[model samples]
Target: MDQDSQLLQAATDFAYYPGSHSDDSATEFLNRFPLPLIINALQTQFDVPGLESALVACLERLFKTKLGASLIPEYMPFVQVGLQADSQAVRSLACKTVSCLLENLDNSHKVAAHLIKEFNMYPLLLDCLINGNEEVAAGAIDAIKKLASCPEGIDIIFPSNKGGDTDLGIIASQCSSLGRVRVLALVVKLFSVSTSAASAICSLNLLKLLEAEIRSADDTLVTLSVFELLYELAEVEHGTEFLSKTSLFQLLSSIISNNFTDSILRSRAMMISGRLLSKESTYSFIDEQCAKSVISSIDGRLQSLDTSDRDEFETALESLGQIGLSIRGATLLLSGSSPAARHVIDAAFDQQGPERHGRQLAALHALGNISGETRSENDIILDAEAEENLLRLLYEAASKSSKLTPSGLFLSVLQQDSEIRIAEWEL
Candidate 1:
């Protein structure tokens, strides 16, 4: 019999083999089906014009047989072909199969090396990263991670967004929240592995794009995902440097201003601000323009807070404390803005409030951080009543618990040392 007929007979015979058959006999019989037959079947199953389901079935059976890995060399062409499959299901299955093979780390590396030599796979994979369904995109990311250490792979995956005019801009614009989340997750994973790549990606304006989406997206999960990605990116070396750019600061201000009711987004914004301020260099670049934007955002939120908005307002106040600590330009924020401060303070002290004490405490801390004591003579405008009220609040907070003693101590320092007060409070 010819090779095809022989392979078909072997497949039929193997199906009938008893479960208790001797290992040696079973191994020998299974070995009778050559690697080429398995490779051809996988391709023919998936590559035919309208036989994607059949292809998936064939691959599933082959995967069950545990013979796919052994035929990696013969399957390489199919992988390349599958990456560009018109049907998302077929492409997704291809990615799954590749990921399954990659479970063997050594084999994964070898496949990656082979893939590097195939130039088409790199761009095709990038396209998958941008437009594929979540499963397919996730699988593509897994494959890229397996090969990320390869120079060619890194080169392919880490290009500047401006390198070539492609559809990513359009895709990013029209992408669903699920698609954006998957793409952001992949980009974040890549950043975790290589700081240089992270810096490059950041400079390419990906963060700005994500920040725009965060401002407009009403979906809590999508906002949470984007915020988490930004938080992760900020933790990288020089990550904050990118964030300190004017565009990013403006975007952040816009998001803060939008003030969606999602607690997670509020908390995430607080976390990101804290991390970005951890770098001293990043702090200096947040100039007066950025400060005005942030202050405007805070003012807008304050005006929107009613009894129903208590939870969201309190979360925003906590974020304000974080912002006060990190942003050097914070002193300029809310200056001559008594209405905004009064609104926030009123919410903080509201009876039966959602986060009454916590909100008051944070606002008090922020007020101390940005008061007029440190401002130049021309810039200073002391609000004696506000200062006295802050001190009273601190005293009350200190009475409530030993935990607030430091807040009391800081308040005393503000009262006693004019220099510390001037530096923090001066715009």
Candidate 2:
């Protein structure tokens, strides 16, 4: 048999192995088979219908054996096809393959750029974001997130409308309940890319579409993602003004009253409250009731902390603190049972250590926000030692990291606070 046929046959036979093979035999067989042949077969399968099932089966074997890395370069085109394929099964497998490839940062950029250039794939992906099966939508969103990580990829994926009928309005309007949910999740992931594209996405009035979802949808993922996206957008220059015009506070109030049972949804609501509270326009909404609920949530989680619950609790507290900063409400919230919250904050600070200094700086910014309302009170004073530590963290973050979100916010807040004196020290 020719080399190609032999490789194909080997792939086909490999798919049926139910258990692990002995290391020596597996190593010998892998050594005999060239990587290019595997890539050719997978790429060919992309255009041929009904071949994805076999390809998936074979790829699973290859992935299991750690032989898939060699085909990383050739898999991008197939990954694109898998993303846009009419077959849900194929699309699902394609998503898994792309996710696996993303483990290598170099491959991620190459594949992401290629996927972004596949213009025909956009509408289908958008549709998948709105109407495809759940697995398909998840996969498509995952692909989009990876692609959006690259600036060139974002430019290609989110191109400007050339003045024709390119408004996302019709698509956004027609979204079914489930579609809206998935779209919200996708938008949140997209918004998390970088500040530049995030600004562009906000300009597209994507949040308006999300506001519609927040008002009409009940899905936890959708609601949470919407809140997260809004929070990110609010951190941008123009986002606060855009958010003020919407009935965001009213919608969040409704969600709070009716859906507190859903922890995920509640968590998102708290985050939105925090983001809105960061802005002056939404400060009135953070009344006694809202503060109490947020504090209670933090207290409850802290009382019964677990590894899984720590991340969510930290997020809730971070948002709560931001809200407190926006409205000068942290003293009351931080007074009683504040130690647990402080623990969470301090843990967030220490987790980043000196190497991940940006995260430490963000923790300091969060601390600043939390302490802003009570800087005068001895009960919640910003001690000199803590201030020095925060300054050190911010300096290290600025000098070392490229441009992290947390550290950026840290620098902005530190610069705004006249109490912070740079002339006294370096960084």
Candidate 3:
């Protein structure tokens, strides 16, 4: 038989149900076959639908063996070229073949890198992800998932912003594979990088879509992802500023204020609310938006600290301390008869672990800030007494662990308010 016929027969040997292959003939046939000739033939088949589809099938069969696996990555570009075929049938098969090559080349990252760099497989795979063909989309998902393991590959799979539609992420979401949980997970992974990744994803204004998901999606992964991204985004000035404009602060405020059955969600809401609203600068916004509800919700949560909800309890205390930094919030803290202050002080003194200590430090800091707030006409004496209680808490914390002394000593000067006494630090 001629060389082509021999290679064809060898591929056929191992192509059926890949279990317990009893022969080395597949490996032996691939090793003797000239790699350059096979690749040229595959490329040449691009315009011939029947030949290209058959050839891709043969390549898939070949890659099931050791020798073919070793050679496929090197010639992946020729296989990739078939993706441009006019026939959708040819295109779909090409995507599947590419996935096979990617699977076989997991260890050969350089080759995978080369395939993207040379053939621009990144955009090609995204098209597949968006393809109407489920088989092709599924194939591309595997390819994208594999590529994502390489960081640069993530950017390749996730589009960079080019000033397109604002809801690009959502638009793309509609085209994503069926049962889009994996797609949502991938989006979260991309957003984890930062705003750039967020923008690179759906559009320049990806946050709008993400916020929509956070507000509307009933899925846990989707809501949690939005929360996780929001938290991470808060770490950077750009992200935090973007979030502040959105109803994020309001959403978080509501999430904590409501009696959400999900304890973890409640805990996250409290932590995030405290994080975003704690700054004195944010006080005006909170006062205008959620002053009354913030006070009432945090107060109720603190009074009902269940052991199963200890995390939420600790987070609520932290939120309480933050609330004290603002005028509207400080009003709640300054009330001498309010159990909110007492709950905060009691929770603050707990030496259970480092996390609890951190929560305690937050409470002390809030009291310290409230002390410096110019008290209103009705509660000067009461505010002063609360200040004294705060100093006592600080001293107790410092005495227990000298490590806590720094947090005790940290101070901040609010823009609208005077200097912080317990010491102010903004994270």
Candidate 4:
């Protein structure tokens, strides 16, 4: 066999070898075909059609074991070269290797610092983020997040000074809209790492970059992308405080209230708005006026949705549940002149077809959420009419819908509140 064929066979052996066994089979295997040998072959034999792919697969499997992961730092030079290789697959693999390397370390800060200050790989990672393909870009994002976990690393990723040589804002300015979106997503990830990381992100005013993208409204696809990122940010613990500092709450409410906005964008905006208010801890971040505006906008949306708009209808219902997660938000839903609460009840009892059944499921979930299915006793403050609606939902959902049942839905809610329990028994 030629050298390339020989290396391919060796890589296949490495990929298939079970490294998790007690016998240290990976170590035994490496004794015969060391990582250095494979790295040397990869450096010189990259031109060989299948060698790079096989070696990369072998490396990925090896990364699953402690012994295999411990050996990667010595091979950083090959990784650096792979990141700059002409082939997309190789660059993506390089990024994955960096992630694996960081994920496995006990003192990752040391390696992270070396990668940035000594190995000079940070720029190459950024290059992959900006110019790589989808897989490569995802891997780069993951690696950058892993690097950002440590205080020193996060400082490097988001420096104190704005518009510095390494500022992500500057990097994003050089990216296409899609690339900028990717960077925005990276910022969210970094923000979730620690409080210090979040402080770093806020201090540099990186969120304004995302806000600028959303307000530009020039590209529907790009705007949607930023909204999705905002949704992710909203999901992070304490992320709402970071978001509340910006005008994002008002911006999202505007997108939701605007009849001219794209339906899909409006739907996403409503869901994001709901998420911002869902957590009781974060509920106070949004002022009363803004929250009321959101409820009104979503009510208008639900009223506008017909049978043909099932997806939007379901989305709006789900968003309502998110909004009504808190007692205050649910109070707005139940007290408003808008028929939003009635609409939720009607949708829950609407058992027409498979499509309506789907909406029915979402509406049922929304109803349970709105009625304090998961709140503390002191927090579960449902009024008489609202209590009547919950009881009605239990009764009607059982008898009215042959295709579904609300027994499982109400069981938990029934357990939480004595009044509802008594009402349920009295019926």
Candidate 5:
């Protein structure tokens, strides 16, 4: 047989049983044919109905070897073309191949740069992610994850608004096509690109698209995935601040605090709250009703000692701490007969992981900020016991630790001297 026929047969055999092939045949195939020709043959073979999976398997196997890794660039054109192919199988095969190339190659930065600068493949990747088969869609998502990793690649995956690209907008409009898992993966992959990407995502109004899916989904993985995406988005300085302004924040807060929400999902929501509360300006934006719902969630989780959801519990404490950072929030939590202050106090003393320590510090900062609030003469937010509980917890924390480390913060010797004020919180 000629070299071309020999190469195709060998690949077919290897694809069906990677273990059946030896390095000898794979080496001979590469030695006889140029990378472009081999990639072309494989790309064309994807049209064969039953051979698609096997050919992809062969492509994956070839990419694992040194020769295959070096020739990744040769497959670039084929992949870009295949991404837009009318055949679902061809599109899926191309996506899987790109994922494999990115995974096996050491110089992915170069590969990614080639794909974006030379190939301009982001739209194709986005298209596959939106419309490809499940496994193929996942492969597209993986390619996106790689593209979002490097500076140049990140710029390509999440272009500035001037690019005249509307793929994200299309994804938002067609969100009903995305299930919860894909939705979570897409959001995470997009935000990881950059803070600027976060801004672009905000423009998409992505949360509105997924709102119903998040509310109605019953799977734990789905629930957890959605909330985690919310946390990731909220962590961004640009995205969640805008998101918080919309009723979306309140809706998520209510859903998360609901009794039926999974523990992990609830924790994810609490994380979003904590991130928003991280900023004093954003802290003020959380309205009273939203804060009340947040408080109720914290109280419910704190009371659930029967279920040792420590991570969720810690998250609740952190959210409550953020709420406490605001005067309005602190007053609500530390108000007369409110269990909020007591729960915050107990969380501060729990002595769990370093994570717990961070949560405690957040709670303490909220308390300190609350204690410093000078009520109007007619203000009645804090009664006698509330003041006493607030003072007592502060003094206890002050007496116990020589220094405070509240999630990257360090109180100075001067600030340490302020510990005496903990005892002075008498109303």
Candidate 6:
């Protein structure tokens, strides 16, 4: 190895320090190669190929230790300079280091406050977010998420009172479609931090950006990306309630209801609708009619699909399972005017051959959910006719030994209520 390679290897060894090393070993390592000296070398040796990344790996591993983490705040100037570096690699490394700094710090909030207020790093980070390569942008996203973990950081991120030059909405408007998608992703990240952050996003009407993307229907890929982010937001705590007030549900309903839209997009819309209604708490915030409309839209979409549209067919079943996770959702699916739960039943028992196995599995899962597998017997949401269908299937499974090839049906039958089990036994 050359001089630079040897130096990097040595730094890696000490930073990583395999197996159990005592405090004395760390002190010895630090005494031999002090953290500041390494930081200085990193800045001065920026031109060396592979030196930046290797040293960054060393720094990240070192920061995992208490000794290295304690010195993070002291090197804030280095981070600030690296953030502004002309080299995209250096900027990416800097973003990662900012995350490393906050992650290891005992008082992350105070240090994040310092970075936002004193160092004025948000704009630089935002620049990385908008223009950097994939790794750089990802690092910037993580750093920004850490910054938003505290109250003061939240204000800087969201900027409640006025739209600054650094406001996400302004940045999004100036960006290309791709950049706008990145901004939406960042918004989702920020929204995941706390209810207050979610409220801030709503207060700023940032979700309108997502709404606009979905409604535009100009680009299938872009709209799909927006739906993915929407699905992510739906999975966050209390996310359904937050989305309830928006026109998103109605928009998704229309997409699912429309025949000309991309089947994949309609499938995504169906899943999002299911997720939004998965929790009962969501019902408190959403209108009953809106929920019904979403379910009906999905039901209509399912009914329109022939067996050849296997992807949409399977996804619609899975979406119904998500909705059936709750009692009201199960009731809506099983007892609706069109009765979408029947699709789940037909999918479970009607299909044959290995080609249709996935469809059957999805149906089995939906039936399990609707029958309250995770809930008590009193909580099973299937109505009388639906319940009767489920029992009849169980009884048929129990009576006929020839019908157990798709073991999922037999397993699902076994997972039913004790009363149903006794009835199946008698049959």
TM-score of each: 0.57, 0.50, 0.45, 0.83, 0.55, 0.85
Greater TM-score among 3 and 4 belongs to 4
* Model 6: worst 10 consecutive residues (lDDT sum): 418-427
Residue 160 CA displacement from its true place in model 2, Å:
2.0
Off by over 4 Å in 2: 1-77, 84-86, 99-120, 162-169, 216-247, 250-327, 332-379, 382-427
lDDT (tens digit, per residue) of candidate 6 on 122-143: 8888989888888888989999
Angstrom error of the Cα, residue 362, model 3: value is: 9.8
Candidate 5's C-alpha runs over 4 A off are 1-29, 32-37, 40-52, 64-67, 85-93, 96-120, 150-155, 158-165, 179-184, 203-225, 231-249, 256-293, 300-337, 341-427
What is the lDDT of every predicted structure here?
A: 0.56, 0.56, 0.56, 0.76, 0.61, 0.78
Question: Please, what are the lDDT tens digits per residue for candidate 4 over residues 241-317?
Answer: 77878888778878877878888998898889889878877666767787777788888878877898888888889
**What TM-score does prediction 4 earn?**
0.83
- What is the total number of backbone clashes in candidate 5? 0
lDDT of 2: 0.56
Q: With candidate 4 superimposed using the best TM-score fit, by how many Å does residue 33's alpha carbon deviate from the native?
A: 3.0
Give the per-residue lDDT of model 3 (tens digit) for 56-159. Answer: 56566666555566666666665576566555655665666665555664546556655765787766665655643666656666666566555566555544
Clashes of each: 5, 0, 6, 0, 0, 0
Question: For every candidate structure, what is the RMSD over all alpha carbons to the true structure, in angstroms?
Answer: 10.6, 14.3, 12.9, 5.8, 10.7, 5.1
Over 1-427, each residue of candidate 5 has an lDDT whose tens digit, in order, gives: 7644566666677666636445565676667665566666655665444545555567667766666665667667777887898767678767766766665556657655765568767778777877777876877887777666667765675566643553454455456535445755687667655665555566756556456557666566666666666667666656555566567666656766577766667777777766665455665555657666666766766786442565666567667766665556666676655557776665544445554544555455544445543334444345666567666655555555654433212232223234423522331
Candidate 2, 70: how far from true, in Å?
5.5
Global CA lDDT computed for model 5: 0.61
- Give the best candidate by lDDT: 6
Tally clashes: model 4: 0
Residue 33 of candidate 6: its Cα lDDT?
A: 70
Could you tell me which 10 consecutive residues in candidate 2 have the lowest summed lDDT? Answer: 418-427
- Candidate 1 accuracy as lDDT: 0.56
**Poorly placed runs, candidate 1 (over 4 Å):** 1-74, 85-90, 96-114, 117-119, 158-167, 170-186, 212-232, 235-238, 258-275, 278-304, 320-393, 396-427
Between candidates 2 and 4, the one scoring higher on lDDT is 4
